[model samples]
Target chain A: MSRVLSIVTGANRGFGSSICQEFVKFSPNKEQHLDFILFARSADSLKNTKESIKTLSKVANVIEEYGVEMSDIPQVEKTFKDCLDKIEWNKYSKICLVNNHGTLYNLDKIDTFTDFQHIQKNNDINITSFVTISSLFLRKVKALPNFKDLEVTMVNITSLAAIKPFESWGLYCSSKAFREMFSNVIAEENKSSPNFKVLNYSPGPLDTDMQKEVRETCSSEETRQFYLELKKNNNLVAPGDSARALAKLVFTYEFTTGQHIDYYDIKEK
Target chain B: MSRVLSIVTGANRGFGSSICQEFVKFSPNKEQHLDFILFARSADSLKNTKESIKTLSKVANVIEEYGVEMSDIPQVEKTFKDCLDKIEWNKYSKICLVNNHGTLYNLDKIDTFTDFQHIQKNNDINITSFVTISSLFLRKVKALPNFKDLEVTMVNITSLAAIKPFESWGLYCSSKAFREMFSNVIAEENKSSPNFKVLNYSPGPLDTDMQKEVRETCSSEETRQFYLELKKNNNLVAPGDSARALAKLVFTYEFTTGQHIDYYDIKEK
Candidate 1:
């Protein structure tokens, strides 16, 4: 049985976990099953998640997971390399790597927040690690004997914070913006590659932990009320919707790669 | 007599030190007298530079100096506070801050060069610390009742890298871009304030140690030839020219506040 390799970061919960679930459901060819590589910080939290996935999982291929903090700078190469060691390279012809992990730091008053620890944490996961992991695996994919047929996709989860000045979303927004520009260059440089697909995805107004913190800290009463109303209207998107959108993007990877793919755009598509 | 107060960051060498020299040379009553404050990482460097200034330095006003590393996040705040602690607040009405520091990281393969020690160094001084210091000082100016007549101008020294993507200058370019955007917001938010001025300035391509390193690093014959041609053709700018250009921008600070003022744009003015 040939293996289809898929790696999802921040896969313990939220959109990352949701992405993995859809990969199991919509992934083509059960006979050429995908070996799911779930990367996250918490293994215990995933124990409960595994039970739910067991019920919904449609693909017969086995799930191989990595319990490591992608944000931890020193461990990234070692951890990701270990997973690659286990994979049977010949079995996989396509690699879909989704980087859904993100860290949002609260820093409206620069003087009040000069904590390097917080800055280091945000920079590591949100910007540097994405580049590091993508570059590492990209070289590997290119070196593979199945390189000609392989579609090496790198999808980065990004935000609207780049365009709008969201209060206290400094670290998060800057990181997202960097990712967008980074992916743009990658796409341009690899224009001729038939199977090389790199995408920057804006997940769009999710009712997630990061958003919850934003609502609490924002100084503007009007902005806070607007978000609260937005959530109440169920105007906020669900992780499942993003997951489905991503799955669709991958299946139609030919059309969506290289540009920034927003969840809002998927609705129109 | 009121003291003329100013602070210059990255004053250890090059345009940073030259900027400090220009400030000291601006004759009291030429516009207004200023008691200057100099900031850099080396106390010894400032001491030697101080000798040249003592002759023309304001007779009655004092020039206080400090050593502070911008990378130490908390240390910037402490350094600024230490400066503030020494100054008799009642003596000075006008505040001028110059963010004139930049750094380059190891240039190598874009995909493989994952070591970010140099990137972080640049961010600490050029981007993060600049914002932190400016944000704090702006609020202070707003908070003080005596500062009603005070005009506080923050000048961020940006580079060509802010707009262009030079292969070897990834981290430096990204940080400058970040600084430009940061100052843009500060300007927009302070649109109503006549006294608060946030400015971004590119000093042009000067023959600083940084530039010299860039020239030396292009050891390849093809690339070195291109740079040699650029320099010979009068394309390269000198440090003195950049310093003089910035002085004019500061002289016309009231007119150009909250906007980009490039040394390259000297002709139009």
Candidate 2:
């Protein structure tokens, strides 16, 4: 039989693909088992990713669902609904959902490239879709009888960008900050649900294309200098390193489900 | 000249009407300097309100912009922008904008209501439009070279319902909470503005029709009980009293902006 499925969005490259690799390492084979229902907007990206990770585990059922952006609520809702229909809730004791996909919105030059549409898109994809999808997920799990005993862990992979907003990243920062509060409310809502854990994490800076893109896009001389300074101080962590650390937290961290787990918080705990 | 052209949305009843009355108390002059525009969606409601508020000393600009709903962003954006355009910002020292009109999303059973569009609508009006309009106001004042010296005050008439969300009030409560944070961010942005003060206030339960309507809806047992407790304890302040308290804050409490001002906070300060 197929191993219990784990779904990861934006798994073409960067943080998302790293998360999938780590999930493979910690597939919860002790009680039951786990596989991956990989999700990304680009099938070509997913295809390349599938090839790279193919040798990792032949038994690992990498069910790929590409071309779904988290911001597009209708597509996400339908895709996940189909995935739910296909999956066996009884086989999996827990559905560890990693919301790692995010669209970066940087208004470098207010006059040049500052289209507020980017902000709206960021709000839709990064924040609103996460919430809408989560609501759908809750409805799905609530429908299952055996899964009634299991808690659903929702790990929102947020960034330092949420709080420490830069000048150009106005929209992206605001949406992420708002999303943090939204998730906090969600956690509060699930207080009665013992099996529900919603974790908002600030994974330390990773050497990714997103980071480089942001660096290139930022217009403020002071802010650009600050980024350089931060980088020179060796502040950025590798995605793979961060992934392993996150994997450890997911597997070993025996805390309640609905806490905002930042890197400092996790280390402190 | 009109006593600082003041615009209040949803002014037909509840907190909006009360806001109109209270604004007059702290005008530049009792006779001539007062322009209070009352806006609502319904023609009947607007006319009835116009008749009630019409007086010699204080001129009420009864605008038939139709009833503005917080949930509909496009309608709100257009209506609010149109209403804003007619007013000359130079005539008024302080354009006191009190967004007191709001509607709670509730139902006997949620499925009867359809989708989260209503919830989306509530946020659009109460949160998104509130912020958007405030931004427009800031831009308006900033555009004029002379108005730069004058003070502008924004008081968002919020409810205790937002602080502690109840069943059936998911959208209303969360939207208010979200708006507060959004307000804070905006406040931080406008800190450098020579004359700007923003405050989010929970006008202790007013004896408005909305309160009675809330009581009548009676969907969630918990919210019903809470309302009863407030009414029993005389915690519910009359709209006039609430409005007076808010007006005083707008004029005299310009020092205290960017904070979530509660009824108790006013008393304490």
Best candidate (score: DockQ): 1
What global local distance difference test value does model 2 have?
A: 0.64
The sequence of per-residue lDDT tens digits that candidate 2 reaches over residues A64-174 is 555787656666767777877887677776677777888876645222332333444555676556656566666677677865567567777876756553455545555
Q: Write down the DockQ of candidate 1.
A: 0.29
Expressed as tens digits, the lDDT of each residue in B1-269 for candidate 1 is: 56557677777788887776666664436546666677878766786557656665545233787888887768877777667667666767667788876566544434555554444455566656675677666666667777667767788898766655454455566666666666665665566678778778888877778767767774335545666777778787777677767766675564555577678777334
State each model's CA lDDT, in order.
0.68, 0.64
DockQ, computed on Cα atoms, for candidate 2: 0.21
Instruction: Give the Å shift of residue B208 in candidate 2.
Output: 4.0
